[model samples]
Target: MVDLRALFSSNDPVGSAEAFTNRQNQWGLVATAIEDHLRHIADPGFNVEDLETSRNNVVHFHGVGGVGKSTLLRKIEASLTAADQRPTQ
Candidate 1:
């Protein structure tokens, strides 16, 4: 059986990258949204008017407690951090 103590011991939701798993669909959704947002912002003709019928830059994740919601968010944050540190082409 898995131990809950180890998971709860750390203040960090995700203990490490290795501990995060099985959320490829969620990750893909978030990553795509972020990429689209960045691409839109980088466009010279992009304006707030363009979002009139769009998602308004919001992505929501909802589930019962202790279902790895925080963990998923932390993993996304880590991914974004790693991406930010990479050299731009």
Candidate 2:
């Protein structure tokens, strides 16, 4: 559900290239899912849109113990890639 368009977008270019790119991609996934939330719920009339985008939106999913953050990222990436292959409206 992540808006693949947002993945290539960046509100901040004020950091290391690698880190910035990763952050942008991550947020794109989160935003996409969020934006599509209403459609996902079978409420066709309700829609969500992202208005204020910020550099601070970036979140590092890091931890020492067990967590599926990385796995989730990978899964999202794969799903988005597949979705992109489909024709867009």
Candidate 3:
């Protein structure tokens, strides 16, 4: 379950990370799409044609209000931020 206070609070980054819950499938899809996009850009051997037909460049999340859309975005942002800070190679 999501922790509502942490979801709504901008001051608590750690709390927000902890509050995010139960969207492993969605997160996995997003992560895979991101990886594919990066590969398309970075890998000379990767077929750009395949990416044109096989994957979408955008991940759209649509649902009624108050269903944790904002919270999920926050989680994605935190994850990407952490990944960006990691040492490469």
Quote model 2's TM-score: 0.29
Local accuracy by lDDT, each model: 0.69, 0.48, 0.68
Candidate 2 regions with alpha-carbon error over 4 angstroms: 1-54, 83-89
User: Using TM-score as the measure, what is the rank order of every candidate, best first?
Assistant: 1, 3, 2
Instruction: Summarize candidate 1's per-residue lDDT along 1-89 as a digit string, tens digits.
Output: 44657656655454344444688888888989999989978889777665465555788998544557777777666766777674342
75: Cα error in model 1, Å: 0.9
Q: Best-fitting candidate, measured by lDDT?
A: 1
Work out the TM-score per prediction. 0.58, 0.29, 0.54
Candidate 2 has which clashing residue pairs, if any?
2-32, 3-32
Per-residue error (Å), model 3, residue 64: 0.9
The digit string of per-residue lDDT tens for model 3 on 1-89 reads 75766555544444434534588888888899899889777878667666455655788998644555677777777767767674332
Off by over 4 Å in 3: 1-20, 45-55, 82-89
User: Per model, how many backbone clashes are there?
Assistant: 0, 2, 0
Model 2: per-residue Cα lDDT over 8-84, one tens digit each = 36453222332323355666768666566535555664334634533232435664222245554665566557676
The C-alpha stretches of model 1 lying farther than 4 A from their native spots are: 1-21, 47-55, 82-89
